[model samples]
Target: MAIGLFYVILLGCVLLNVCFYFYFSKVCFSNPTTYTKNVTPVSVIVCAKNEEENLKRLVPQLLSQDHPNFEIILINDASTDDTRFVIEEYMAQHPQIKMVDVVNNETFWGNKKYALTLGIKKAVNDHLVFIDADCEPASNQWLSLLSSPLKNDTTIVLGYSGYHKAKNSLLNALIRFETVLAAVQYLGYAMRGNPYMGVGRNLAYTSKQFYDVSGFMSHMKVMGGDDDLFVNEAATGNNTAVVIDPEAFTMSKPKQEWNKWWIQKKRHVQTSKLYKTKHKLSLGLFFTSQIFFFIATILGFLFGLQWEAILSLVLIRYVIVWIVMGKGLSRFRESELIPFFPLLELLLVFLQAGLFISNITHKPSRWK
Candidate 1:
């Protein structure tokens, strides 16, 4: 009887997972194959600190984007490196590129939020598009693709950010898998009218909407509120839109080492505490379900605790995750790694649990 009950629970979780997956797949995302022409005035904001190397490549890519009325604002965030010098050189050549210096600001302690705020203050355009120094848009039409959604909703536009392909290591594969999974969940949630956080690597918002929220006051002292925290505050049901179009995607470099990756993940995860109550509830439910599934599967296999029942339950859990993640990867062109899905799923579950525990107990994370 216990064995039968275990399988029943496992199958129930599987059905729930499958239902949610198909529901999101049908409602949340539409293929972004349709391209729209220049319709909105855009200002691209980039915040950089000692990112000279990445800036050299990423800036040119921004400049080359096929948007009609947009200016690139690169904020030099008091870097001890040659980031300023390189931007100066680029400014000398490209008249369209503008540079803003964010050194010695007293009102706002030095952070990316302050730097971004300064740049936004100087922006001359109505639409505000933000990307990181370490990211590049997937296509020249990237700006147009991201900005096009604003015509329908002026409040928020969330775009996808994935890691650039590095040499095929398990680390790179896992990072890519995580990125795809996040894109699916966040975008999928938005489809169901529950938009939470967005990645800053490629997000767009209006200056008016940003000011209305009072902009990051809730997480001002936190190390990583600039992107996710800001999104948590700014997004709403009627105003927020997710653009999963290939052209709108921005690609970033993954952390090269596990320690660095862990720290980054922890810093990113810390902002979840500041999310709105609804977002918090949804994320809590999702995470709780994941933990329950993971634990129940483990307990089942150990001590012959309904081995068949447990395996069936675990397989159901895996299938649900696999289908959702697979749909996401397919849309993002990451299907190449589908063969390694089992390893990727296990690694992510392990890493996510470890990171969540550490985030709850660790010190305020530092960027360096």
Candidate 2:
């Protein structure tokens, strides 16, 4: 009986959070707004790691951004492949682009974080936009759309990132679902005036803001922190802005397999330990509710609880998850996945549980 009561409480908390998330999604993207136009000097940073093929395509697209006073800075982080050669060729062709070469030395800091720090140090702009080598801006207006927010004390710019539509496998669908959730959670928080994280694939912030927060100095030892951790420190009530203009979107490839996806997710979660206390508490509570609810479902079935009551709890839970996720899907333009929400949500709950349990064990996971 106590366990059943506990599950009821868990369900209630989770339902409240779902409602809050729905509210956030509505308020955040209601206006579909962009920042004011300001000629802030902008630098786009690309961290290339064995991205030989992608650079051939993505670099040129990045170089073609229509911003008047922006330069492209590509950091070659210990690439043993043709990534350097491709970059060198591009450098010779484009004078506005600068390249920094780094070795495979994880001596004092994480690889991606160190590469980003190096790029920022060499950047000569008031605003810095970071993107991966495998990603390309959706349109030429990308820079303007991303940088427009700096006019008003909006120090941090959170932009949208999606996967290329070329892949249509189940894995790709799962990645799409994951991207929608990220857009919902982080961008939703920004709407509620409490931005906590940003994605490295397409995020922007002022150079002064980066230095002001010490530029990932504290979380350097961890394998991740280039994006989310940095945002946790820099973004506050009035200092952050989220850009959802379709033209401002960036696209990258989805992971090819479940194992690789798990590792990528684990690497991402490694930085969660560095999140601010409030953010940590919110995420902990959010995750705890889902975990306990799942446990309750299993226990209720095992103990021969009244079938109608068990069905009632399960149906209510699904309805709440659907509504929250539906708002996210509609906001992020991922309505096609609405039909597959049941399977994806179930997979996500299990996946999230694995991540939490693995995190508890504190063992290092292999990077994909």
Candidate 3:
């Protein structure tokens, strides 16, 4: 009976992984063609808080975008550092740069959503593109490629944002690996016409859509939902699109310390509670399957259950993962991480389990 139970668990894990592979093979194989000719004017809004150095490095790239008509709106969110001065200096040189300063009120402490709302209101163009202060465009054509999908009546445009490749550290590898995995899931779902979330580091949408969905009012009190939650609330299957062109990618600085990354991830996980029911169930199933797969495979081997069947199931799953994930890695320009996927995949299963547990008891702090 115990051996029979092992077979049941092992088969369940194999079946779940097979479902994921089938989804990847069917929906996420092809890259969407970008529309570059009918580019519309865009307002690129960036919210910054004491990121003077990054602003200096990345803002100029935004200014030099190859697009024909676009404005860069920099929101200085009551930054105590040289953030304001840096923007002032850029404004002096660039005619397209606009700066909105949010003074820090002692009695009323506002989060990132407040600053973003101000920027959206202040935007002159109908289309608004959002990115973090620390993000740098992968190419001069970033603006053109990112905004092109909007011409096709796509209300929400999701672009890829990855961390710059670091030298040597397991933490860095884990960060990059997890990021690639997320991009695959979100982007793949968008391709499958079940669009759910997008990253603010490189996301675009129309002002009309923002106001139509009431713009983050649903979860305004919670910090860190400004991107994913807003997309979840606003995006629909036909209205959303995903762009994975290399030129559309935005690279951001990765968190170096373990504690910092953990806090950042915890805050992000907290927002999952508010995701649409369909998305919540789908994502939950994927993670749960991953944990069960790894755990069941180990037990099957240790308990000396059907050795031939166990080996066959495990090998088949790995092959499927490699083929599907290999194509996804190629599309996202994350080929280097492909060799490390096996080890990282197992580690992430355990890590995600811990994060989900911690999420239930932890209270999220204000977004920095």
Winner by lDDT: 3
* Model 2: residues with Cα > 4 Å off, grouped in runs: 1-7, 10-14, 27-29, 104-106, 165-168, 365-368
Question: lDDT by residue for model 2 over 99-201, one digit each (tens)?
Answer: 9888766474336788888889999998889888888888998988988887668789898899865446888888898888878888888878999998999
lDDT of each: 0.79, 0.80, 0.86
lDDT of 3 by residue, 1-368 (tens): 87788778878878887797677453348856757553688999999999899998988799788988999999999899999999999999998899999976653375888889989999999888999999999999888888888855688999999998888888888888888778888888888888889999999999999999988789888888899999999988899988888888999999999888888989988998799998999888888888888998887788777789999988988998888887777777778889988998888788888887888888677777
How well is each residue in 120-232 modelled by candidate 1, as lDDT tens digits?
Answer: 88899878999999998999988998887776664788889999887758788889988887778788777677778889998989888888888776777787878888887
Per-residue lDDT for 241 in model 3?
Answer: 80
Error of 3 at 317 (Å): 0.5
List residue ranges in candidate 3 displaced over 4 A: 25-28, 105-110
TM-score of each: 0.92, 0.91, 0.96
Query: Using TM-score as the measure, what is the rank order of every candidate, best first?
Result: 3, 1, 2
Instruction: Mark the 10 consecutive residues where model 1 has the least summed lDDT.
Output: 26-35
Please give the lDDT score for candidate 2: 0.80
